[model samples]
Target chain A: MSELEQRGVPEETRTEIMEATFRAVSEHGYAGLRMRDIGEEMEKTRQIIHYHYDGKYDLLANFLEYIIEQYEGSVEVERDVPPCEELDIRIRQCLFGPGFEEFDHWERMKVYHELFTHAQNDERHREIFDEHHRRLRDSITQVVAEGIERGDFRDTDPERTAQLITDVIHAARERKLSLGHDDAPEEAVQAIDEFVVDSLIVDE
Target chain B: MSELEQRGVPEETRTEIMEATFRAVSEHGYAGLRMRDIGEEMEKTRQIIHYHYDGKYDLLANFLEYIIEQYEGSVEVERDVPPCEELDIRIRQCLFGPGFEEFDHWERMKVYHELFTHAQNDERHREIFDEHHRRLRDSITQVVAEGIERGDFRDTDPERTAQLITDVIHAARERKLSLGHDDAPEEAVQAIDEFVVDSLIVDE
Candidate 1:
């Protein structure tokens, strides 16, 4: 019975390993990362990894939690729907809002790719993903439905319209990340401005 | 002259290493993969990798080339401006044409992440990413501009509008990947479908 016994893979120790694993996986990815590498990066030992987490899978679940936490904490998560009329505005407000005013697309892009790749093959991973980017799509769909009810949006399918909005948002993030370079400027951001307005505000 | 001192790495041998690296990297990812694994996968020796490619960078370049050949080669690279009407159709045709039709999003998604992350610190890497995607974005903008001039699309800012289109497409791909395990049936794809028709089809 020593420090290892005291620690004995407690929640705190598990969380620390998972957090470090997140960085390693995000920077390197799932395939190349080694137990020793994680230990070295965090200045711990491989036994610590074994002690706190059963193995890679245990560490993966916890790493996924961190990935999803960032998502819910992102500009997209919603607790309650906004008025149908103002959902678009809310979306843009959060996207380019002062809260994320200091956000850097490049730094976040790798973590996104890491989590997203897992989301494809891992069920728990996808839950974490949808948990984050939830409601924006539904809200958009509801907006379309509401518009139809209000006799504003077109008579087309609301659900379909919602998916497109989701698509647009998803696609924009990819382009934004891939296209964001040191040389790229504000003009890049300006280019996609008002996309939501155009997509949804049916021609009068 | 030994293997290194020989005339050069034979093109077939070089191509083999590239092909082997492509398979290895795709399965294990750039960081997770190893030179030894690439050799074993290809049924050759580690020396074969050294003979054909300098190291990881060289393997990555060749892998990138394979991606371009396998993936980019499929895209209809139209450099010239098509007629306005044709251009509009082309935009819809490529993006809305298929959600999962042309390429499996998983492999392409990984390749995308690979190039994008590598581009963070490497100018040449960014250059490759910039060249392919910017061309596609520019193409969409040109179409929007033409539609505006000829009065096909609405009188909106073509530059900004085109970016929005690009963004939505980007977002849609992400949603497809991110929603990999959503309990929702193809509802997400349906939403994107309607959005395309709404976004591109002009009001009569």
Candidate 2:
């Protein structure tokens, strides 16, 4: 439905280039990212990368969108799945999932943090990051609302509860990435599980 | 007494330079920050900034340490005060205190986020960031343990409870900075207050 969806296979090359950019960024940082480094990562000419993107900024903007899409696609709260279970899966994914385990996951998160940090000063980039936040919040809100409706969760403020969960998960992720915390994910899972059980679950 | 404290009032110039760097990064962002822009912000010759620090990277690393020290010095949980009240004050500081309301607050947070994102690949920067995280966590943990000991709060695992509080607060700050959420601070205060009451308060 999106332009990205319509492009299909051609988008694969775009994604490949984005991944290469990600590697360069992970190794050298956003400030240090260079076309030559990206080209070296991709084993292609800078011209080829330039053909796909105007410059580093342009490539990074698209890369931001691409990773957002990839993340959104990875976590699905299915209709048949109990909302509580779905919430667990989502939280676990945020903390201990393969995404957290893999270097690529951490790398992508670092770049995402870079975009977020940059968004504070760049109006154009702010819009992209804002949309990403909206989508992420909406997805979590849906799960919270469904859990309440299914009678799995207590009758509480869905939006506030969802926001709380998001805040905790995000804090954990940020600390882990920036502080080189190996235990953050597990600690997050334990903390969230306890918080949810105490604050959100309906008493039998 | 750290090197910074040892410098005393003579450090006013150091703080001035750091503030100038903050303004430059706040406007142009970390990646775009240049010595010329920093000098222009301070209305000082580039030679002055260069004389104090070797390069942009050196200036930024020192700037990171400066801000971290600044933040650590902001909040204090007094021994004679009721632990619950101390906890309340600390949470409010994280959420809606004047510290969070000032433009300088947002600017500093943005710059701190920049360092965090950059620390992913830079080991030296990572050590600075790691120390910052540890100190923040320890501060929160002390408040939680005191609250529990004084029976101003429920008996709970203080470390885990502290981590939960940190996660939610951090997430709220991150989202506010990146997504342009004007309401995040207030929302965070509400969410965290309610979570504490429900999860940790002992019904008297």
Candidate 3:
């Protein structure tokens, strides 16, 4: 937070504005958000954000840098996923947990999807998406690789397996969004969990 | 083919328009398409198409209905899998082969992706996407259920398995898009196909 502010605004102000920015961007999408709205929410002048970060582009860049930095810093891979007999269950939970059943998850996906659409035409947005995946795959691969070595998983190709698990979660989210409206059918999370778990675990 | 043109222009004319529509819509997306371009390509007046049907709206509707009909009518169930030693390899190819190589797959994906994006606002587009899944899933599920009965597959829940496989492909397409431009990376296709195959098959 200090680093982000030093790069632009004061630490507290930047962090507070960023919280409002994420909340606004996540809910209303990039198109619907306005600097005045964020200022009003945070009880700060729009000029403050502008003076600190240059403009919207700088704000977007700093916001992503801050978020990705925090994402990387907080994900203590070795500590987060402790291993045991319920290894498969833990892996499944980590990937497709009901924890992601939060409303924030859905809105977050919508925001990301909107950016993905724009990324087709904008190089900067595409870079963000690419960086997100590269970091995610690397981090997950480390845990899955370690799990296999510690006898928690089958001696399968960890890189391949990590990508597979990643794709499964990605697919499930798409399914939720596609069928997410009023008339769309609900899918059982446990069934999908089994499908993911059984697909990856050792036959023993 | 015969069924679609029973009410339209000469069968050849209708077929020509539909094929061009698919190529155009699939390549440039539905919103990117123009009725006049389709008319010019067919070398026919809008009046001709209007006389045959209603207009561009009718033409696109008939085209979608036609694809749906063709999908249901002529789906190959792959009965020849025939208890082989290399069952997983064959099954993998069956799920994601032929139409999904580096060729028009991007274009195909583009149209569906466009529909997915617009479906956020358009109920009609969402219905078309859901129906596409329903018919495709029904055909695939029937094949899977029969395989389970025959002791080929592990007697897993057929509908769920169908959903998972479709979801995998859907996600892989998205991941690949996020990673590369135009054609999916060769590595992505191989990785996706191998992961999907590995998950679906029983060891011989």
Q: Provide DockQ values for all models, in the order shown.
A: 0.39, 0.71, 0.30
On lDDT, the candidate that comes out on top is 2
Clashing pairs in 3: none
Better of 1 and 3 by DockQ: 1
- Candidate 3 is graded, for docking, as acceptable
Question: What's the ranking of the predictions by lDDT, best on top?
Answer: 2, 3, 1
At residue B83, give the lDDT of candidate 1. Answer: 38
Worst 10 residues of 3 chain B by lDDT: B83-92
Candidate 2 displacement at residue B42 in angstroms? 3.3
User: Which interface RMSD does candidate 3 score?
Assistant: 3.4
Across B12-110, the per-residue lDDT of candidate 3 in tens digits comes to: 777667666766675455655677766665655656666776776667667766555543454443556653223333334433443533335455454
Write candidate 1's Cα lDDT for B98-120 as tens digits: 23443454556555555655554
What would the per-residue lDDT of candidate 2 be over residues A66-163, giving only the tens digit for each residue?
87777878775567887878888887776554453335576677677777777776687889878777777777788889878888888878788878
- Provide backbone clash counts, one per model: 16, 0, 0
lDDT per residue as tens, model 2, B1-204: 765556452576886787788788878877767889889887556687777677888778888888788787887666788666776787777665346333467778877777777777678899998887777777778877877887777888888888788778777777788778878888987887777645666677
Span of ten consecutive residues with least summed lDDT in model 2 chain B: B95-104
The chain A TM-scores for the candidates, taken one by one, are 0.60, 0.88, 0.70
Give the alpha-carbon lDDT of every model: 0.56, 0.75, 0.57
